[model samples]
Target: MPSVPPFPRASSRTHSSPVYRQRIRHTVPAAGCLAVLLFLIAFGSSTVSAQPADPAEHVSSTEPSTSSLSSPPQTIAFTGGAWYDGTGFVNDPLYIENGRFIAERPASIDTTIALDRHFVVPPFAEAHTHRIDQKGTLEGAVDAYLADGVFYVANLNNIPAFANPLRDTLDRENTVDVALAHGGFTSPGGHPQPLYERLVDRGIYSDWTKEQLAGQAFHAVTNSEELRTAYETIRADEPDLIKAYLMFAETKNASGLTPAVLAELVEMARTDGLRVSVHAQSANDMHIAAEAGAHQIAHMPPMPFQHDDGEKWYLIPDSTAQLLAEREVSVVTTTVLADGFDDGERKERVRSIQRENLSTLHDAGVHLLVGSDTWGTGQNEALYLHGLDVFDNQTLLRLWTDTGRSIFPDRAIGRLAPDHEASLLALTCNPLSDFTCVEKIDLRIKQGYVIELPPQTTSSP
Candidate 1:
């Protein structure tokens, strides 16, 4: 078992709800990468099962395997392509050595792939999403993301039971690299509570009891004391980044953390050197999160909420956008989520708000990241934003590539430059002229290795 962090002792509160006090039991076996491969080879199914009666019996004590380290570095050359260099595409022959772009050509080349004058761009990234977290959705989601030319993903809120096993499986040559925010912090019975319960109701997690799922799904911290207690589990979970939720902060009895509590949580996360991504559901939520020193706002306040006075228009004030821009906190564009609203009038209303908010944020110089935050990849979000006519093709490209990669700053990816990770997508048409051409991926390359997909899906590198 991993040791928990020793946080400073604080006064306690007696909470009756299990979501607030129940200690999480990490039931997933830590067998790591080898188990994933073996399981796939044996069952050919991506859905992982719950641990057996003796869960500890299967936890492997060995170190996770690093297949890339033992293999000798290979040199590959991509010729005759117009690669995007941040601003625009330049006709240049790119070289790769040991899974990274190289300025100097190697003496010996292992293979040469001709790009056939295709448009080469850094692979797309998802800054905020939960599509790749669950076992039932993992395999198909990965295939869809790669087929759409998206190579980087972030699982914003997931349980360790499902996410921990795949920690070693992703960020490899063949799979989409992921950054997991295992179990977000939310108010008791807040946004994700209903989300997870619906999954169980839909038989997506039929085997899981609500009690077993609640503790693993989210930390229900309402005050400073609750925040400190949750830190113990935060350390145990070892999240890549901290996740905070702020919804309807202006409401009288909203189901979210207070401004003071959120500030405390942000301070703690900053002290621990972890970036914080806050889920903001409304303009007030976004303002509160930015003021609390959140590094990223997971959403652009896409949906409107019923205010205390029954107003539904959720528009971000110019001052709030300026604050976010001044703080340099990137906001993810999940405006596509509003497309699924059943009410046509409500959908149009939400879309109007999204367009206004996006323009405001863009004009204020606030960085925006591309993310669908739905079952699909970031391509859909990119298309939606393009349709809004706020951002040009080049700006959207940079947001999906460069800004999106900022979610996981530790990785050297999302750029077609020397010493950057050698992952790119080749499209048959110039995406700059026709934005739709981005969906037409001709070839995919990841980590200096050729990636082969099914026919009509994508070609080999």
Candidate 2:
């Protein structure tokens, strides 16, 4: 088996519950078996099995059949299209088989797909988004993402109780892959607490009690001991990443984690073997998060200093940009969601600040990952439109493909290359020329499975 980092020793308090002990026993062995099976497959061994078998009786023969050893690989080829393989666009045919891209054509062809003048690019990644709904199925959200050629979605804010089951359902259905930051670390009455209260008051999750809501949505750490316990509790759910919220003190009616507490939380999460993603809206919060060793900035931070002449323009300081770049921390651009501001002037100012900050970060060599922070609906297209104001289509494509790959290095999702998953989007026109062409998605493929697009309705004349 491939070497893995040692699992952290859990405290007796962490495994105090019978249910927790049972989960550990079941999940650990299953995960270990999976790792061993994957290792065997990688090394070209046929000892693994789908079902339990007697190891001694199932030994492979030294002399294998010639036909079995020499059989040609199943091939599927796509002709007449330009492929954007993360770095550049190449006008050539691409081939795939067994859900992976092959360098050369196979001896025999199993299927051939004609692209005719379309642009084939890697499937998009929704790197930032919240829970689509607090109740019922996530089918609407999942379908919306898939329709927009987003095969992988990183749900930045999620309740473990809800996200875990939803992830399993989506995996079983083979619709979309979801990476969840199950809940987030925040102070009592912080950003999400107020938001969660509104959700409950609005009857969105009326069935949930206040205690349950707090348990699912907010970690609310006040001190070191609480911070440690929060880490253990959240880690027990096995989230893909950890999310920490850092709100400025100037924001009225909201409480937030102090810098010291935030730093401690980040350190504890890293020690537990999780990447820390922080939500920082203000410039100070952004600096604090970066200095605390966060792996990613979940949103573009607002500028700390504003012009006194009533101008909306704001610039990120060169020193802050350098710090982020030096740490190699990526920033997920959610500037598109600036439209949510109630004041028009405030909205414009925030947008201006985000654009300037994004430009600075990009110039400073910081990785910029594309994220919509909006629900997985028609908003996917809106994200592309909004991003055009700051980055060109080529850079935007890279944010979606190359930068996204860095977010999940173990998964083969965001690139068209050998040994990568056949997840891609076929656009009617080249997006590099006009980013708006993203809306004209001709087809979507996930893991070599073609997703049938919904038929368009014709209006009566």
List, in order, the clash count of every candidate structure.
0, 0
User: lDDT scores for all predictions?
Assistant: 0.70, 0.62
Off by over 4 Å in 2: 1-74, 132-137, 249-254, 303-314, 376-388, 454-461
lDDT of 1 by residue, 36-101 (tens): 100011111121121112322222332122111111226666555678887887766578887789
Q: Write the per-residue lDDT of candidate 2 for residues 293-406, one digit (tens) a residue.
A: 888988776522222323322356777788889998888877666555667767667666677788889999988877767664323524543554777667777777664475
Off by over 4 Å in 1: 1-73, 304-313, 455-461
Tell me the TM-score of model 2. 0.77
How much lDDT does candidate 2 score? Answer: 0.62
| Model 2 residue 309 distance off true place after TM-score fit, in angstroms | 14
Candidate with maximal TM-score: 1
- Give the clashing pairs for model 2: none
TM-score of each: 0.81, 0.77
